[model samples]
Target chain A: MALRNAVAQAAVSVRYVVQRFSLALLVAAAIGVMLIGKADTVLLERARAAALDLAAPLLEALSRPVATINRLIADVEDLANLRAENARLREENARLVTWQSVARRMEVENAELRGLLNFKEGPQATFITARVVGDSGSAFVRSMLLNVGRSGGVTSGQAVVTGEGLIGRITEVGESWARVLLLSDLSFRLPVLVERSREPAILTGDNSQLPRLAMTQSLAGIQVGDRIVTSGHGGSFPVGIPVGVVSSVGEGGVRVKPLGDVLRVEFVRVVDYGITGLVTGPAPPPEVYGPPAPPPRAAATKAR
Target chain B: MGDFLQQLDRWLYAALPGTLVAFLILLTLAPVRLPEVLAVAPLLPLMAVYHFCLFRAEALPAWLLFGLGILFDLLQGGPGTPVGVSALQFLLVRQAILGNQKYLVEVSFTFIWFGYAVLSAVAVALSWCAVSLLMWRFIDPQPAVFQYVVSLFLYPIFGWLIGRGRGRDPLNAPDPRVPGSRP
Candidate 1:
C-alpha cells in the first residue's frame, strides 16, 4: 500500500510540473514574438556588441591559421611567376595606350570648356578608410560591417565606395562598428543615369541576387553594356559615381552588374562629406501657375 | 562573516564564458554569401537556438534571440531582409520543441532527426517566403528553394552529432550560475 501511494504521488507531481512549465513557456514565447516583431536599432546594437564580444576570441584564434594559409597561397602564386601575368598586361597595356591618347585629348577639350563656362566649384568629398571586421553570413542579406564607427567619424547614410566604384552606404553606426548596406540589397535604390544616353532611371533591387532598373523611360535607345553612373539629383549620392554596366536589358527590366564584388570586400572607404552650409538662400516663393514649357532635348545629345 | 563573503563570491560566477565561446565558433563559421544554396552553409543560428533551448533556455531568452535576428538584419542591409521574421521562426521552433518535449525526450535518434528535418524545412521556407514577399517578387523560388531540401537532408546527420556531442559532455551542474564548487 505504501509503495503504490508513493508511485501515484510521483506521477501526479511529474504531470503537474510538465503542465505548469509548458504554460509558463507558452506565455513567455508569446511575449517574445511581440518583442521580436518590434525589433529596432537599439536592439540591433546590443546584439552586435554581444556578437562582437563573443566573436573576438574566435576571430583571434582563427586569424593566425587564415594568415598562414594566405601567405602560403601567395608564395605559390609568386612561384607561378609574373611571366604569364606580364604577358597579359602587356597586351592590355598596348590596347590601353590608344584609349589613353584619346582620353587625354578629351580632357584637354573638357578643360577648355570648363574655362569658358562659369560653373561653380562643388565641395571636395572627404573619405575615411576602414577595414572590414565582419561579413554578413546570410544569403538573403548583402551587407558588411566595418571596424570604423561613430568614434571613427562614420555616420549613417555616408556612401561606402572602393577604388573600383560605389559599393553601398553606411546604414547603422555603433561606437566602434558600422554596417554598410550593399547596393545589391533589395532595399537599396539609387538614381542612376546611362553614361551614353544620359537617360535617368531608378536602380531598384528585388532581392533576386541582382538589382534591376526601374522607371526607365525611353528604353528603345538603351543597350546592354552601357555604363550607369549616379545622378546627383536628390543630393543623396554624388553625381557621376560609377555604379555598374548594364548586364542584361529586357522588356521586363535591365540588370546591372555592380562594380563591387560585395562578397570579398576587405577594405572600404566611407565618404565623410562633412557638415555642409545650410541652404542660406530663402526658398523661392510658391510658384504661380504658368504655362508648361517645351520638352527639353536629351542632355547627352547637347553634350555630344 | 568569512563564510558569508565566500558564499557571496561563489554566487557571482557563471557559465557565460563557455556559452559565448560556443557562439563565437558558430559566428565565425556562419557563411555570408548570396545564392543561399551555394554560398551559405547550414543554419548557425539554428544550432545556437537548439543548444540554448535544450541545454540552457535561461541563457538564450527570447528577447536575446530576437535581438540576434536584428543584428543579422543590420548586417544584411538589403531590402526585405527579415530579422523579425527569422526571430519569429526561431521562437516558434523553440516552442514546438518545448511542446513536444514529453514525447521527444523518450524518442530515439531517428525520431529526433526526422522531427528536426521537418521543423527546419518549415522554418527556412517561411523565411524565404517572407523575404520574397518583402521584395515583391513572385519569381521562381528555384535554387534557394532547394536550401530547405538541403536542411532536411542534413538534419539527421546534424541531429545525431548534436545529440552525441551533448551526451558525451557532462551536464551543466544545477548551479551553473554559482562560482566555485562547494566542498
Candidate 2:
C-alpha cells in the first residue's frame, strides 16, 4: 500500500510540473512576441529599477562593514606613518595660512569690486547632507546608492554636490535610499559654462572616469585647467557652482576632471532647493550694494 | 495523498541542485571587473543547463530554465531586456542533446565544451542584439566581445571541474548503459 501511495504521489507531482511547464511556455511565447513586435526599453528599465529598489537596502547594509574596515585601516596607517604625515601636515597648514590671508584680502577687494561693478548673487539654494552607501560598478552605467531617500527629502532630479564640486543628480528614490547617477554615467548630461570664456557646452558622460565636454561653440578660447560651472540654463543647478576643470582639450572636444572623487566617495550633500512651491516665481533680485543705493525702479525713474 | 507527498519531495530535491548551481554562477559573475583577465566569465547558465542535461535531466526542465533566465534579466537591471530569450535558447540546446542522447554521450569532454561554447555564444549574441534593437541605437560592441571571449575560454576548465565533482552524486551517476557502472 505504501509503495502504491508513493507512486501516486509521484504521478501527481509530475502532473503539477507538466501544468506549470505549459503555462511558462505560453508566457515565454507571449513575451517573445511582444519583444519582436517592438522592443520595450521602458519595461526592461522598470524591471531593472524594481530590482535596484529591492537591492538598495541590502547593499546599504553590506557597505557598512567595508566602510568600517576602510576607516580602521586608514587609522592604523596614519598611526604607523605619523612622523612623515606630521611634516606633510605642517607644510600644508603653512600653505593654507598663506592662502587664507590672501583669500581675506581678495574677498575684501572682491566686495569692493562688486560694489563698483554691480555683480550680484545668483540664486537661493538649500541643502541636506547624505552619505554614500553603495556603488554599482558596471561599465555600462555609473551610479551610486545613498542612504538618504524620499524620507530625507531627496527626490529624483535633485542635484547632489560635494565640498569639491557637483557630483550627480538623484535618479531613483526609495523610502530610505536613493540612487545618484554620477556625472560620469553614460546617460548623464549637464549644461555647463566655461569659467574663463563663459562659452556654453553640454557635458556628456560615456561611462568613463572622465566625461567629455560636447556642444562647444568654439574651443579657441578654452584651455586645460579652465574651470567649468553649472550654467543654470536648465534651472537644475544654481549657476556658478563648480562642476569640474578641463583636463584635456582637443580640436573639437574637451574632457573634465570631475571635482568629486567618483572612485572613493563616502558622503554627499543633497541640495534641497525647497523651491517646489515657488517653481514659477522669479528669483529674488540681488542685494543693492554701495551703501544701500536707491531701489532699481526709483533709480531708473530718476535717470529718466 | 501519500503518493502526492512523495512526488513533492522528489521535485523539491531535484530543484535544489539547479538553484545552487544558479546561485554559484551568479556569485562568480557578480564581482567580475576588468584589467584582470577573465573579467566577465562565460555564459554560466549555459554551463548549468549543460550539466543538468548531462547528469540530472529530470531536475531542470525547459520551464525552470526559462524562469531562471527571466529572473536574471530582472536582476541585471537593464529593463525591457528579455533574459528569457537566451534561456529559451539554452532549453533548445538541452533538448537537442537529449534527443541524441546516445550519440551525444559518446563525445569527449573537449568536444562537448566546444559545442557548448558555440551554442552559448549564439544565444548571448541573440539576446544582446534584441536588447540593442529595443534601446533604439547601436551601443559599442567592445563589452559583448569581451564577455563572449572570456566565457568561451573558461568553459573548458569549468566543465572539467564539474565533470569531476559529478562523481559522488547519485543523480550524476553515470548511465546504466555505460560499461562498469553500477545501477
Candidate 3:
C-alpha cells in the first residue's frame, strides 16, 4: 500500500510540472506551424482545403439561416426604397429601349465583321453558381468561401462575378469549397482597361474599399467615373468583363470603386474561360510590366 | 442505468468548454454579409476563448485550447491568418489566464472587461507582428485596428451568454502557479 501511494504521488507531481511548462511548448508548436505555412504554400493550401471540407456540413446548415436573415434585411430595405425604385425602373426601361436598338445594330455589325474576317468564335464560357457560405472576416486578406468547389468544377484562378460586375477570382479550391480573393485584398492585381479613356492600368488592392490604379499608360485621360474592365491581357479572365469605376483622381493616386457591393454578394458565378494550369495570385503579366508605350494598342488592333 | 447517466453527464461537462468554443468559431464563419459586418465581424471566437479560459480553466485546458485555435484558423479565417497563428494567440490567452488566475477570478464584470480589452490589444498586436514578419512587409494596420475595436465592444454580450452556465460546475481548482495555494 505504501509503495503504490508513493508512486501515485510522484506521478501527480510530475503531471503538475508538465502542465506548467506545457504553455511554452504549445506556443512554440503554434509558431512552428505558421512558419511551415509561410514556407510551403501547397501544404498549407491542402491543409486548409481539408479543414474546410470537414466543416462544410455545419457551415452549410448554418449558412441557410444566415442567408434567410440577410434576405429579411434586404426585403425591409427594398420596401423602404419601393417608391424610388419604381420611378428609377420606369426611367431605366425608357433608356433601355434606345440602348436595345443600339445593341441590335452593334450585333449586326459585329456578326458581319466576324464573317468577313472569318474570326473564330471562342469556346462558350462555362459558369457554376455557388452560394456564399463562408466569409473570411480577415483584416489583412479580403476573401470569401463559396459552397462550390472542385467537385462543382471550380478551379483556382477562375473569375467570379455577379450581375453587377467582377467581384473577385478563385484563389484556392478544395473538393467542396473554394475561396475567392476579393478585389480589395492586398494581393489582388488585375490588368484592366479604362473603358472610355482606353488606358491600361493595374488595379492593386491595398485592403481598402477603393483599390488604387498603378502603372497607368496615361492618367491625363483617366477621370472620375471612368469605367474599368478586365483587359483579358493575362487571359485568366474573359475580355470586357466590367470591374469597377474610377471613384477618385488626385495626387493621392487614382482609386476605383469596385462595381457592386462586394461584401453583400450572395450568389457568385465562377467562370472558366477554358484556361487552366493557373498560377495563384496571377502576377501582373510580363507584357504589362514594360514602360507605357502607347494608348490601348490591343483595342486599336481589334477595331480594324 | 443511473451509472450510465452519470458517466454521460461527466463526459458532457468535460466536453462543454471545447464544444462552446468550437460553435462560436463556426459562427464567425457564417456569411453575415451586412455592409461592414464582413470586414468588421467581431472576433467572436477570441471573446469565447477569453471567457472560458478566465472562468473555466479547469474544463478548457491548454491542449484543447490549441486545437480550438487551429480550427478557428482553418475555418475561413483569412489569408493573413496562417494555420497556426490563431493557435498561438489562443495558447497565449490560456497562459495569461493561468498566470493571472489569482487576480482574475471572482472579479467584477468591469474589471474583467478591462483585462479582456488589454488582452485583445496584445493578441491583435501579436497577429500583426506575426503576419508582418511572415509577409516581410508592413501590412495596413487598419484591419487589425477595426478587428480589435469590434472584438472589444462585443465582449460584454459574449460574456453574458457564456456566463449563463457559470453556475454549473465552474470549479476553480487549485492554482499550480503558486507554490502552495489552495482552491
Best model number under TM-score = 3
Tens digit per residue, CA lDDT, model 2, B32-90: 22223443435666667776787677777766766666555544432223445555665
Model 2 quality (TM-score): 0.64
Predictions ranked by lDDT, top down? 3, 2, 1
Ranking by TM-score: 3, 1, 2
The residue-level lDDT of candidate 1 at A132 comes to: 66
Question: Is model 1 an incorrect, acceptable, medium or high docking prediction?
Answer: incorrect
Comparison by TM-score, 1 against 2, better one: 1
Candidate 2: TM-score, chain B only: 0.74
- For candidate 2 chain A, which ten residues in a row score worst on lDDT? A275-284
Give all TM-scores, in the order shown: 0.68, 0.64, 0.86
In each prediction, how many residue pairs overlap at the backbone (N, C-alpha, C within less than 3 A)? 3, 6, 0
Highest-DockQ candidate: 3
A111-140 per-residue lDDT for model 1 (tens digits) = 888889966756678889986655555556
Ranking by DockQ: 3, 1, 2
For candidate 2, what's the RMSD? 10.1
After TM-score superposition, the amount by which residue A222's alpha carbon in candidate 1 deviates from its true location, in angstroms, is 1.4
Off by over 4 Å in 1: A1-90, A116-119, A274-304, B1-37, B51-84, B101-113, B129-167, B171-183
